[model samples]
Each structure stands twice: as C-alpha cells, then as structure tokens.
Target: MAEQPKGRLVDVELDDTIGRATPDVEHERNVAIFDLIEENVFNPAGAPENGRFKLKLSLVDKRLVFDIRNEADEPLVTHILSLTPFRKVIKDYFMICDSYYEAIRSATPQQIEAIDMGRRGIHNDGSTTLMERLKGKIDVDLDTARRLFTLICVLQWRN
Candidate 1:
C-alpha cells in the first residue's frame, strides 16, 4: 500500500495585524496552536519534499494567506484564500460562542449545552469549508481543519 503523505507544523505564527483579541479569543487561539503543534497533518501541495513545515497565517487585502516553509526556514509554498466563503460561518460561530459564554454565567446546564452544540456545529461547518477551500493547495484532516478554522476566526475577530 502507498504511504499516506503526512506533515506536521514545527512553528506557527499569527500576524500582528490581527490586533488585540478578547481574552476568550486569545484562549481559543492558544489552545488551537498548542493542539495543532501537538498533532496535525499539513501537507502542502507541490512542496519540494515530505517533511515538517512552519506556517505563518495572516490576512492581506481581505485574503487569508498561508505562508508555509520547511524546518530549515526556507520558503516552501503560499496559499491565498478568499475570505468570502468564511464570512457567514465565522460570524455565526462568534455569535454562538458569545451566547455560549453568556449562558455559562446564567443559563441552565441544558441551555448552556444547547448553545455549545450550536457552536460546535458552526465550527464544524467552518472546518469543512476550510478543507474544501484548501483543496489542491493543502491537505488537513477534519480535526486539524477545525483547529485551523478557530485560528482563522481569531484573525477575523478584529477585521
């Protein structure tokens, strides 16, 4: 059987221009980064060879950019994606997250759980959309995509 192509992220950076995110947003960003570094699949299409990579994510001119490089710090590939497809999903995710957070403070357990379920659903939608948009550019599993989507939403927080 042919071996599956796999790549891990050695380093991840989010651009400074993303601005000061809320405490909750920062926590989510940190958690996503940590989880992604711990385990991920980041095989960029047309890479020179199979190996771990470094990633710098940023928004430029309303486009989401993936700046990928090798462990040696050599540039590998860059993929730019339109933010249009993500607008609604990201907005919905934020709304649901806000509701979830607020619910935790006052809502009943069942209410909080319900809001959390909606949050997860929107998150999943964003993750699936991310994977589709990255098609032919990079390959990442659903979990990785979900974490990456969280980071993307952080970037969109101030934009």
Candidate 2:
C-alpha cells in the first residue's frame, strides 16, 4: 500500500459575507474545523514538504479560493476553483440537511435515521466532487474532503 501523506491543518479562516449563520451551521463549522485540525492530510501540489498548513477559504467573484500557507506563514499554493460545478450538489446537500434537522424535532427514530442516511449520501457526493475539483491543485483524503465540504457549505449559508 502507498504511504499516506501526513499533514494537518494548523489554522483555518473563512471569509463569509452572509453575516451570522444559524446555530446548526455554526456548530457544523466548528466541528469540521476542530476535526480537521485534529487530523487531516493536506499536500499542496508543487509545494515543498511541510508539517502543517494554514488555509484561508473565501469566495471571490463567484470562485472558491484556497489560500494555503506553510506553518511559518510563508506562501504556498493558492487554488481557485469555479463554483458553478458545485452549485447543484451544494443545493441538494442543504435541502437534505434541512430535512434531517427538521426530522430530529418531530419525526420518529426510523424517520430520522432515513433522513440522516440521505444527508450522508449527499455529503459524500459533495466531498467526492470537491476532491475531483482539487485533483491537481491539492491532495486530500476523503475525510478531509468531507470536513472541508462542510465548511464550504457553511460559507454558502445566508442569514
């Protein structure tokens, strides 16, 4: 088996224009960020070997920007991806997340489980798409991709 890349996110910053987000969204962001920092694989294409990385995520001119840096705050790779490809999946994920959250309030256990399954499915799809988009720009494992996808979803949330 190939050796897994060993890198983690030391810090993360999100540039969001949507003001404050919902409690659920904020919680999701916090969990994702915490989990991401605790464990992750981040290898910027063409960058020299580094122990940990810092990432600044932002949406500029409808493009998703990944401003990555090394531990010493030195510049690394900056990947800019089009948001068009992620539109449909993100929309679907948000819809399913809404259903899952609402199900927790009034639905039976079975119903909540079913909705949660759907939510996970959508989340997986979004993560896969994210990996594909970052294929040549950055390398990340599926778990890292999923957590980053959650943060990206939070960025799209509006007040």
Q: Global lDDT of each model?
A: 0.91, 0.88
Per-residue accuracy of model 2 over 58-116 as CA lDDT, tens digit each: 88888888999998998887889998989999999989998989999999999999999
List of clashing residue pairs for candidate 2: none
In candidate 1, the residue pairs with backbone N, CA or C atoms under 3 Å apart (3 or more residues apart, or in different chains) clash, namely none
Error of 2 at 12 (Å): 1.2
RMSD list, candidates in order? 1.1, 1.5
Candidate 2: C-alpha lDDT: 0.88
Per-residue alpha-carbon lDDT of candidate 1 for residues 1-159, written as tens digits (9 for 90 to 100):
987788778899899866888898889989999999998988888875457899999999999999999999999888899999999999899889989999999999999999999999999999999999999899889999999999999999866
What TM-score, computed on C-alpha atoms, does each candidate reach? Answer: 0.96, 0.94
